[model samples]
Every structure is written in structure tokens, then in C-alpha cells.
Target: MASAPPAGQGQQGAAAAASPLAPSEMYRNYNFLLRLDSTEVRFTECLGLGMRIEPIRYRESGVGNVVRALPGPVAYAEVVLRYGLATTPDLWNWLKRTAEGAVVRRNVTISQLDNDGATPRINWNLYGAWPCQWSGVPFDALGREAAIEELRLAFDRLDRA
Candidate 1:
């Protein structure tokens, strides 16, 4: 009653022809990640030294409201790395009422910047830092890779004593 895949028709050659793009052309395909700058910063701060680095996943909004079911004017965030240690104590709690709840925004203030470079100095200002209670404080520094590298290096050196 049902027909076969058309013999070798659905085999190697048939599948190959069905493909839209060539293998070599894969690299040519457009991916947003391709545009990510090496200079762009990625930062993450654990509530405590015991907190290990993990991928941050959350429901938030940014820029336009094209997507739905996410936070309005939500921020997926910009800083992109994990912090195992800290130069200063994290005041994530008490700073905002939504610190544990999912109803707040991560407040980040990019106070400093480098007109020509990606990595810049940053300051994480917590406590009333943002409106809806909790918020991830952003960079507030100005410099090139110099300051950024310094901070990153410092974070790596955070050891429990």
C-alpha cells in the first residue's frame, strides 16, 4: 500500500541533493554569534566563593518587545563570564527585594567605556541599584583591555583562605 523511499532514491545521493547548502558553505551561513566581538565583556558574580561557575539562563527582555512571555524591557544581560572569587563582598541580597524572586531586573550601569576597545573598566553598584528590586550591576569603568584584564585576573586569583 505504501511506496518505498524510491529505492536508492532516498539513499545517499538523494539526501545529498535534498540538502540546501553545501558543506563548505556552512561557514558562510549567518549566525549572530559570528558577530560577537572578542572585545565584548562577559562577567558573572557568584553569591559566594563556594558558588561555582555555571551557564546563566533566565527569562528576561531587552531592547524591543518582539519576543513574548519574557520580561518587558527585560535584560538577558551583557556581562558573560563566571566569577569564582571576588575583590569585594557581594551584596546581592538585601540590596533588592527581588533578589530571590523572578520579578525584578538585574540593574547594570556601564559607567566607563573605551571608544575604541571592547573590554573596559566596570563597577557593580548594588542596593537600590535598580528599580524593580534586584538587578545585576553593570560596568562603570573606562579603559581598554587593560582594566578588564586586571579585574579578570584578580577574579581568577580568588582563593578560599
Candidate 2:
């Protein structure tokens, strides 16, 4: 025959089961910032921050029905940043220089902040990034929307910190 648990010990297990588990620290996507060469830039949207590795498949003559894949060159995707039109002409000037045949490469960093919105939890560093494309906001007199400019950047390498 098994003995029963102590008077308070049985209630302790029940209390723990009734209580909900504490959630881990999770960051919000909206709480992030973008920087270009140490200059903080305010952007409403950022996309295409990723990389891909191409795999090269190989087959040996003696191996039967077996194929091996080898890692190939890595490609970094272009990042697109969108911001509302402002009086500042820094972004415009960068695109203008690229259009004039002078490619000005800059380092870009995107950081994900914690709940405080000030402390950086993760950072993605893009090296040798340059303006590849720029689009002006569409003029919509009927629509009540703020003008937003889009800038596309091509980077040679990407690192995460």
C-alpha cells in the first residue's frame, strides 16, 4: 500500500498546476532601428534582410544511388528601406551620387531593440552597401497618406552580431 502525501504538499502541486507559466523574453518587430555608417536613420519599413547558400551536388562513380551536396557561394539579398519624406536630403544625395556614376558604398546596420526600445538585442551588419535603386512617392491628391520614399541597397557581405 502507498502512503498519501503530506497535508500541504498535495495542495502545492495543485497550486502549481493552476498557475500559468511565465513567458520568456520576446522582442517586438516594430521596436527596431536602422543605421547607416553610425548615422541613425528613421525608417518605417525594412525588408529583404537575408542570405542564401547555393549547394553544389556531386556524384561519385563508385557510389551507387548516392549523391553528396557541397556548399557553394553565398549570396546576400538586397535590403529595402522605406521612410516618410522629410526635409533631410541625406538619402537623396546618396542616390544622386550613384546615378552620376559614382558609387558610394556605406556600412548599414539594422538592430532589434528590446521592450525599452533603446537597448539593442540583435544587430545585422551589411558591408559595402550602396544605393542601387530609389523610388519617389506617388502623388495621390485624393488619398490622405504621407509621402514615403523607398531606397534599395545592394551589399557585398552580411554579418550578424
Candidate 3:
């Protein structure tokens, strides 16, 4: 049985709608990938700063590192940071200061070989850890450029506080 079409619609319009596989000029455009929120995310500091604001994102894996040490392992790591430092020490300081509230990297101690016994066991003790690391290189490199813009806003809020 044939169904009646709209009062003013033409046969061509109906034919276009009926064809599922037909290519059409109408399509969704998705050029931009990043979805950002400007809303302030807050954190409380240990030094009685009360609230620290931050913008957060679940960034890609390459942004951080997971390094295994020799002889089984000495320490494991996950570092996140912004890109803007001349040396490791400087970046380390920035990480310590900026991300103290958001991240941590605990240091694990490995015992050295002693003359007393060739057992040469690792101490495997827990040392202090830094929660945040400078976001690693390839992570920053491979990710969309929009990341820098988002990260800058987040860090700026951190600095203002």
C-alpha cells in the first residue's frame, strides 16, 4: 500500500529520504576534538591555602612515564607537567609547587650490594614521593595543540591561588 506524502513535498525529496545509502551534502562536521570546561575545579592545600582551583582532564598515556629499574626494579614513576622548563631541576620545582594537590610520585629505595654478604638484596623501602610530574615530552607532542591552551588555563588558575 502506498502512503500519502506531505501536501507541498515533491517526489525527489521523498526519494532522497528513502535511500539509506545515498550520499548527501548534509553531514556532521567534527574538526575540533578537544572538549574543554572553563568551570573552576577546586582543591584544598596542606598549608591552609583552603582552596586551590584547577582544571582537570584525563589526558593520554604518553603524557606520563612508567619506568622500571634494573635488577627487578628500583622505583616506578608517573609524572605529569606543563612544557616550559630549561632544566630538570627547574621543572622539578615547578612540578612540586604546581601539582602538589593533584598528584604524587612516591620514591622507592633499593639497597646496594654490601661486602658483608653477596646476597645483594634490594632494601625495597618506601621513600617520599612526588605526586605530580612534568607532563613528559612525547605526550605533549602527540596530543592536540588545544591541550596547551587547556593546560595553560588550568595552571593559571593554580598560580592565581
Tens-place lDDT digits, model 3, residues 97-152: 65656543333232323334233333333234343323443456566643320112
Error of 1 at 47 (Å): 21
TM-score of each: 0.19, 0.83, 0.18
**Runs of candidate 3 exceeding 4 Å displacement:** 1-87, 90-100, 116-119, 131-161
Steric collisions counted per model? 15, 0, 13
Model 1: ten consecutive residues of lowest lDDT: 28-37
Task: Tell me the deviation in Å of residue 140 in model 3.
Answer: 39
Q: lDDT by residue for model 1 over 45-157, one digit each (tens)?
A: 32221223444435446736453342233222223323323354332332234445543333333322233334343323321222222333345567332222112111112
- The C-alpha local distance difference test score for the whole of candidate 2 amounts to 0.90
Question: Which parts of model 1 are misplaced by more than 4 Å?
Answer: 1-10, 28-71, 77-161
Q: In TM-score terms, which candidate is top? A: 2
Q: 56-110, model 2: which lDDT tens digit per residue?
A: 9999899968999999999988899999999999999999999999999999999
